[model samples]
Target: MRGLFEGGRICEEFSAGYYGVCAVGGLISAGTTHLAITPFDVLKVHMQVNPVKYNSISTCFTTLLREQGPSAFWRGRGGKFFGYGIQGACRFGLYEYFKKVYSNLLVDQNRSTIFFLSSASAEVIANVALSPFEAVKVRVQAQPWFAKGLIDGFPKLYASEGLFGFYRGLVPLWGRNLPFSMIMFSTFEHSVNFLYRNVIQRRKEDCSKAQQLGVTCLAGYAAGSVGSIISNPADNIVASLYNRKASSLTLAVKKIGLMNLFTRSLSIRIMLVGPVVTLQWLFYDTIKVLSGLPTSGDDRTDVEQIRTT
Candidate 1:
C-alpha cells in the first residue's frame, strides 16, 4: 500500500500509474459529491422538465416530498454515482495526460490555451462515458415511474429504446459538458495561478497543505459557478429531451423559450455546482498530495525545470 502511494513506485515520474492515480482521485471526488446531491439534482431536473408543475426550488421540493415521499429525492442516484464516477475518472486523468502532451507539443506553450484544449479534448471522451448513464439518470429523475434507479432503469431503457436510447441525448450532453469543462478547467487553472500570485502573494509550493487546499476550494467554486451558468441552457435542453418534454433540441429551446433557458433554475444549479466542484478539486488535490505529487497547476516552469535536471 505504501509502495502504491510512494512517489518512486506507482506514481513514478508522472507515468501511466500517476495518471491512473489522478483518475482514481477524480472518480472518488465526482462520484461521492454528485451522489450526495441526488435530492437537489432531482429538483433541478423537475424544474427544467416541468417548470409549471415543479416551479421554484422550494415549491418543487415540497411537491416532490408530498407526492412521492423522501425516496423521490434520491431518484436516479445510482446512475449519478456510476455515471459521474466514470466520467470524472476519464476527465481528470485525460486532462492531465493531454495537458502534458499539449505542453510538450506547443512551441509557445501557452498555459491558458493548453488548459482549454486539454480540458475540451478530455471532456469529449468523458461525456461519451457519461452519456448513457446520464440518459438513465435524467429519465429516472424527471419521471420516477420510468424505473427505480440505474439498475432497473438501464434495462428498461434498453428494452424500450434499445442501444440508441442510451445515447439519444449524447449531443445535448456534449453541448452542456464541453463548454462546462473548458470553462471549468481553464478558470480553475487561471484562478489558482491568480490567487497564488496576487492574493496569497507567494508561490504555491511555499504554502502549507491546508492553505493549498483552501486555494483549490476557492478556485474550484469560482470555476464551477461560471461553468454552471454557461452550461445551464444545454443542461435544460438535455433534461427536456430526455423527459420527452420536447421532440428535439430546437423544439426544446422553443418550448423552453430563450430567456427561461438561461434563467430558470440557474441559481439553484450554481449553488449545487459550486460546492460540488470545490470539494472535487479539494479532494483531487488532497489525493495527489497524499501520493507525493504537487497540487495541480503549481509552477509548471518548476516542473519542467525538474524534468530537465
Candidate 2:
C-alpha cells in the first residue's frame, strides 16, 4: 500500500497524473467521510424540511428511531457515497488545475483572487455532477416512501419527473456550494499560511507530519464552520425545494422565511460540516504525503514567482 501510494509521486506537479492522484484522494476523502455521517445528514434534512416534526437534535433522533427504526439514519448512503465521490474528484482535481491556470493568467494579481476564482470555477462543474445525486439523496432521506436508495431513487425520480427532476435543484445547489467552496479553499489556504508564518514560526516543510496535519484540521474546521454559516440559507432552500416543502426558490424562501433559512438546523450543520471538512483536508493531505507529494496550500514560492513574472 505504501509503495503504491509512493508511486504516485512520479507524476510531476500540475501534470494530469498529479491531478488524477489528487482526484482519487479527494474521492476517498469526501465519499467515506460524508457516507460515515449519513445519520446526521438525515436528521439535518428532516429538521430543514419539517422542523416541527424533527424539532431539536435529540428529539429528531428519538422520533426517527421510534418512527422509522435505526436504519432510517442511513437512508441515503448510496447517493451520499457515489454523489460526493464524483463531486470530490472534480472539485479537488479541478481546483488545483484551475488554480494554476488562473495564476498563470492573472499573474501578479491577488493570490486570494486566484483562490476564489479557482474554487468557484471548480465548484460550478462539480455541482452539476452532484445535483442529481443530491436530489435523490434528499428525497430518499426526507421522504422514506420515495425509494430505498440511489439505485431505486434514480429511476423513480426519473420516472416521475424525468431527467429534469434530477437537475431541478441545480441552481440552489450551485447557490449553496459555490460560496462554500470559495470560502473553504481560500480560508484553508490562508489559514495554513497563517499557522506556519505566525504561530508555528517555521516553514511547512520543516514541520513534522503530525504537526502539518494538525494545521490542516484546524484550518479546515474554521473554513467549514464559516462557510456553513454563510451558505446556510441556500442549503435550507435546497432541502426545502427537494422535499416538496416549496415549489420554487422564491416560495421556499417565503415559506421557510429568511430567518429560519439562515438559522434553522444551523448548529447541527456546523457540527456536521466542520468535522467533515476537517477530515476531508486531513485525508486529502495524508494521501498526498503518503504519495510523496507536499500537502496543499504550501506552494508559496512557485506562486510568488508566477505573480512576479
Candidate 3:
C-alpha cells in the first residue's frame, strides 16, 4: 500500500497527465466559478456591513441594478479575474505540491488520513500563497462605485495604495482562507468518495461522464458550503482590512478588533453571508466537477509532497 502511493503510477493514472494538470484545471475551474458568482459575493458583503440598506440578495441585486444599473455587479471584475485567477492557479498548484510534501514528510497511511492531512496542508500552503491576491481581490470587490467593470478596480487599487496595497488584507485573508481551504478540499474529497463507495457505489464505476459529474457537483457543493461558513468572517475582515492603509498586521488586527474582535456582530454576519456562501459553493463546485479538476482521490491516506519552481 505504501509503495503503491509512492509509485509513479498514481500520478500517471490520475488522467490529467500529472498532478500539475489538476492544478491547472483547478485554477481554470475556480476562476470561471468566481467570475460567475461574484455578483453574489458583492451582495453578500453589502449585506454583512449594511444589512438595513439591503433586505435580500435578489432585492439587493435588483436595487443595485435600478440605481447603478446592471453593470454594478461587475464593480470589481478585473481584480477578481486576475487576482483570483492567480490565486486559484497557485492554490491548486501548491495544494498538490504541498499535499505530497507533507505526506511524504511523515510516512505512509490509508486514503482517509492522506486525504485529510494532504488537503489540510495543501490548503494552508495555498491560502498562504493566496493572501496577496485575496487582498487585491477584496479591495477591488469592496469598492461599490468603481466606474468601469471589476478590472478597473485593480488599477484603482494600485494607483491608490502601491505595492503594499495589494497585500493589505493578507493577515485576515490567511485567517479566513487557511481554515476554509483545509476544510473545503478535505471534505469535498471525502464526501465524493463516501458517496461513490457506499451510497452510490453501484453506478460510480459504470458512471457516464454526466453521472460522475452530478456526484462531483453534489460533493463540491456540500464541501463548499461548509467551507464558506467557516471562512466568511475572515473573508469579511480581509476585505475590510485591505481597503485600509494600515502600517502593520498587528495594527490591522487591532483595527478590526476595535469593538469586540472575536465577539463582533455574529448574528448579522451570518444572516448576510450564509445564503451567499450556500449559493457560492453550489456554483463553485459545479464548475470544478464540470471541468474535471483535481479532487481528493480514493486513496484516502498520505499523499507525497512535490514542489515546483
Candidate number achieving the greatest lDDT relative to the actual structure: 2
Q: Each prediction's Cα lDDT score?
A: 0.87, 0.89, 0.57
Residues 110-171 of candidate 2: C-alpha lDDT, one tens digit per residue: 88999999999999999999999999999999999999998899999999999999988899
Measured on C-alpha atoms, candidate 2 has an lDDT of 0.89
- Sorting all predicted structures by TM-score, with the top scorer first, yields 2, 1, 3
Which wins on TM-score, candidate 2 or candidate 3?
A: 2
lDDT of 1: 0.87
Q: Residue by residue across 1-309, what tens digits does model 3's lDDT show?
A: 111123323344234454555566556656665676667667765554444676666677787789777766675555556556666666765666666666677565654466556666656556555665565555545555543443565566678778776666666767787777777777767776677666655434355545555666677667766776677657646645665634555765565564434333444445533443344344443444444433334423212111110
Clashes of 1: 0
Best by TM-score: 2
lDDT of 1 by residue, 97-120 (tens): 999889889859678889889999
Clashing residue pairs in candidate 2 are none
Candidate 1 lDDT for residue 111: 80
**Pick by TM-score: 1 or 3, better one:** 1
**Which of 1 and 2 is ahead in lDDT?**
2
TM-score of each: 0.93, 0.94, 0.70
Error of 3 at 113 (Å): 5.1
RMSD of each: 3.4, 3.3, 7.6
Model 2 misplaced regions, further than 4 Å: 1-8, 299-309
